[model samples]
Target chain A: MGAGVTVDRLAELLVSHFGAPADRVAGGVTFEELEFDSLALVELAMVAQKEFGVEVDEQEFTPEQSVAGAARLIDSRRAAS
Target chain B: MPQAMPGFGVAVTGLGLVTPAGIGVDEVWRRVLSGEPTAAPDPALEGMPVDFSCRVPGFDPDRELGRRAAWRLDRSSQLAVVALREALRDSGLDPSTWDGARVGVVIGTALGGVQTYEAQQRELDSSGVGAVSPLLVPMSAPNMVAGYLAMECGASGPNLVTATACASGATAIGTARELLRGGRCDVVITGGVDAPITRTMIAGFTRMGALSRRTSDPRAASRPFDTARDGFVAGEGAAVLVLERNHDARVRGARVHGLISGYGASADAHHATTPDPSGAAAERAVRSALEDAGLSAHDVDHVNAHGTSTKLNDVTEARLVRGVFGDGVAVTSTKGVTGHALGAAGAIEAVCTLLALRDDVVPPTANLDSLDPEVEVDVVAKEPRPGRLRAAVSNSFGFGGQNAVLVVTRS
Candidate 1:
């Protein structure tokens, strides 16, 4: 798989960034379900970078709509690197 | 291509103001026209050399803006958001039907997010670097004001901020006016905000000889054009205006306040803090604004002067008003009442100018008991003066020798 990325790993990172219940941060969960906004997405990006050692291309990825979308963005960036 | 007309007019449909005088536009107008002092002793600065500063008293952020937003934003941004909400409501442009992609935002702030930066620094100094808020960079940047507006308004066209010290507000308005004239956007929210009554700023202005030291009598300290005037009083506030094409406002049957007919911007290249004593660049700013409005000196009847109570600013601005509009024009400086609001001064004065043109009354310069012997301009004093206002000018001169003058006409 690209960057050896997995949903389980990305979901764990999301739990800490949003302070959400660990079980709720799953591949199918959306950012809106936890009420994350643009600022939260920014913080998420920072946490993703530290956790996965990936460089996010903002132009290629905007996770304002969903958490699954954000996880995919992080994995793609990790794969690209 | 042919030479286009200088005064490409735009309609001012809505205004939102939060000043030391009051909260809304009507409240400020009534208090301003009736001649009340807004400056008072700020308890926060009780022990400082200059204990008096004009603050927007009783402004409840959590009540006005919801909890999460109010907590995340800096003080300046909170003030701007409240003002913007009012402006949008007053404009009556239903966002559901409006074209968000075509709308633009151009808000101005001098030291944006300084409050956030200072708080984070204190935490870092005490706790550790890790104690600093992760939101520090995104929250403290000056561009964040515009960025937040873009996010809130869903506006995509030319969202930006201008920072030229005190002229930031007027310059932002001028730039927005051009954006509309150039057909870059159909509508724009333009203005400035500043909540800079901090201890560091107070000490800095005092050390630089820019703030009034008359702490014993705060109300009477900001006496523009008075012989006893020493320095400008620091104030905090925000003002925003909704600008649209004249044709669009009429088609929508929106209430039109006045028309922005002209805007002139120039640099003195003389000094950083002090204005050019010769008043050459300042005069040029006035001439250019009048010319851009396609108006002659004789046609102008009212003026909203940037009459900060400082000795140099008052003298220089008075001379230029006399030289450009003549000594007969009714000149008033609301700063005498609301104090100098820095970047927000010009925007607040612009709102006052539109109100004056619409209401046919000129608000008086508070605390101006005795005009300086050397000054010759007709300073409106004590109470409101009513007349047929044909055209008017609002002047804003800031540090870095930046000057911007705006011309408003009754349409």
Candidate 2:
């Protein structure tokens, strides 16, 4: 949230924290495309809150959303707050 | 109908052990042969009443299992999956080519993913319900040990977890025999696993006075059948055996490690935690197992007593063995070397029995300085005894008065 919450920063978090394959964690790939299940998404939500200090609803963090899209949402939420 | 091969018991084609003694069948057997106790002080139990335990040495989940898989599974399931892979490979059965529906999985566990449950409960208490893991139920459920193994091996047949306390493993093996005999499946992957060394679990057992508190000398804590023995040392591990009908194993040209000739189970109907002092119901299971194998007392060569190192269990088990097999049969408790693996104890002992049959050598019960005068059975101690061991019985009695006995024969 402080620095812009870049797509690259989000990708690093997924790969390092979530055991997501490095090759598969790209900006254009949707979470569903990356095979992140519902349970994983919920866990990701909790991790994101702690890491970025921004509240993200697990339900709203849709599987169809791409990693880049997620970064933009976090950045927008930070600006609005 | 499943073809019945009368007088021919199910073949134990393969065995996989991840135990406190060491990992894999050969490593654990080697350590057991040396009579080296694996118990030591645990940093996690630093402040507890009993600060030591027997842990599976050098078990790295992230390295043994991939980070992706290990992160999702509980410690118990991780152990089961690793052991299962070994078992399947040893059985010479390729899951990719085998009929998935014809393979079954049965796991026995006294406590399943208890560490995970405790951690999640702590998270809930401190960080509210929202912070709790969504994977908690699937990861910590008592049935997930078998469920995860089934998923790992693509086994679609009968899959369930048996939870009869300490007798769970023996009960699982017996139930797997029934599945094979009833033609439920041609191959059954069955065993027991438990990682119950959490602070809460150790504390609970400590409260029950079920653990050995010889903190000064951790290695000498689990002294089965010895007069100076106090109680069992809590441990964690897993053992899996691939079971197939004798004819099926022969047809496939699988290497038969041994045969689970007979299995018997009974309830004491006596007490919750205390084994029947009379050893009545426990004897019934032993006699029934021998009878089921069409074997008499004189036919058995050795006895792998449950021998938990606890006074009640060791004394009662010794009396039962002496009552059933007289004075000449060789007896030993591997628990003295590996510590008490609780739910995994039965299966681990069964594998040891098979190895004993294979090599015709009975490993000594570690830390048995002086045998109890009341225990009249011939307990092999001090060193491993080399002899002709044809058939051996492994006994497992659990809390809630549950007793399970298995009769294993050299193939």
Best by DockQ: 2
- Per TM-score, the best of the predicted structures is 2
lDDT of 2 by residue, B1-411 (tens): 444343448999988999999889999999999999999999999999999999999999988987778878899998888888888889988889889899999889999999899999999999887788888999999999999999898999999899989999999999999899999998999999999999999999999999999999999999999999999999899999999998889998999999999988999999999998999999999998988887898999999999999999998999899999999789999999999888898999999999999999999999999999988899999899999987889999999999999999988
lDDT of 1 by residue, B1-411 (tens): 113377777899989998899889999889889778788999878799999988897998877876546666888888888888788889887766778878889877778887788788898788565445568887788999888877777777789999988888999898888888888888999999888888778889999999888988989999999999989999988999999988889998999999998888999999989999888998898888888889888988899999999999998999888888777799999998899888899999999999999999999999999999877899999989999998999999999999999999986
Docking class of 1: incorrect
**lDDT score for residue B22 of model 2:** 86
Clashing pairs in 1: A31-A67
lDDT of 2 by residue, A6-54 (tens): 6888888887767788899888899998778999899888878777777
The lDDT values for all models are 0.84, 0.91
